[model samples]
Target: MKKWKIILLLAGVAVVALQITNPARTNPPVLHDLAATNPPPAEITALLRAACYDCHSHETKWPWYARIAPSSWLVVSDVNEGREHFNFSEWPTDPELVVKRLDRINEVLDYKEMPPKKYTLLHPEARLTEAQRKFIMDWADAAGKKTEATAPPK
Candidate 1:
């Protein structure tokens, strides 16, 4: 029984290690028309670059810890999902896409989701303070308004 249990535990560990080692997101992220419209303000961009850009942008700045297993899998999964939802790296050039991005950003902020719990756990810096959250929320709102693409033309 003891041997059997040991073997099972080892097998599980192996599987977990394998899953972690196999990165889930590897594509080089891109930024589109970001400079033309919705160019991140220097301060906000710095904040985001330090905090949210890793998983949420095409320009993911990999840390040494990323190479480690377990964490690597989690990180890869997050980057993959983040990109799927809203990739700051791939800012949209089209007005419609820009509107969509703003909507999505608003959704993430209002829901108090995004920069998922797992991400914040490993990446303490990414944790949003009330002030920072408010700043980002305001940024989203203003950008959305500037885009002036809200509401369908009846």
Candidate 2:
């Protein structure tokens, strides 16, 4: 029992020490928000904001856990990776890129691969229902087609 107490104390100290290594959490200014640019319907906008924006936009709402050590590391890393892949706050201007982005969104939704399980496990509110998923997928398909039609010949 005494040995176990010592091990637990050491583990606690290590966890506290690890706090010094926590990544910086930042929400950069939104220069070109997707809504301002492409302008999805209000409902779709709301769905995206609720289900996808935390990690995929500069408007991340850092939760309480994000301030801790190991969890902070995972949260920050996920947000960074998500923004790198699809930053709604930094919407692309080129029509081709816009179309590509929309298509990618649709593909991910079709595969039920987004609002990743790990994220939804913690943020239950981010979970999308079947109807919500269909709505976003349909919007993405239409938006992609529209953007493709307007894109300049390459």
Q: Per-residue lDDT tens digits of candidate 1, residues 32-86? A: 6355568868877776776778877778877765666766766677778877877
TM-score of 2: 0.91
lDDT of 1 at 112: 80
Q: Could you tell me how far off, in angstroms, the CA of residue 72 lies in candidate 2 after the best superposition?
A: 1.0
lDDT tens digits, residue span 1-154, model 2: 6999999999999999999989999999998998775899999999999899999999999998899998999999999999998999999989888888988888888899998998899888899999999999899888888888887788
State how far residue 6 of model 1 sits from its true place (Å). Answer: 12
Top candidate, metric lDDT: 2
What is the model-wide C-alpha lDDT for candidate 2?
A: 0.92
What is the alpha-carbon lDDT of model 1 when measured against the actual structure?
0.74
TM-score of each: 0.73, 0.91
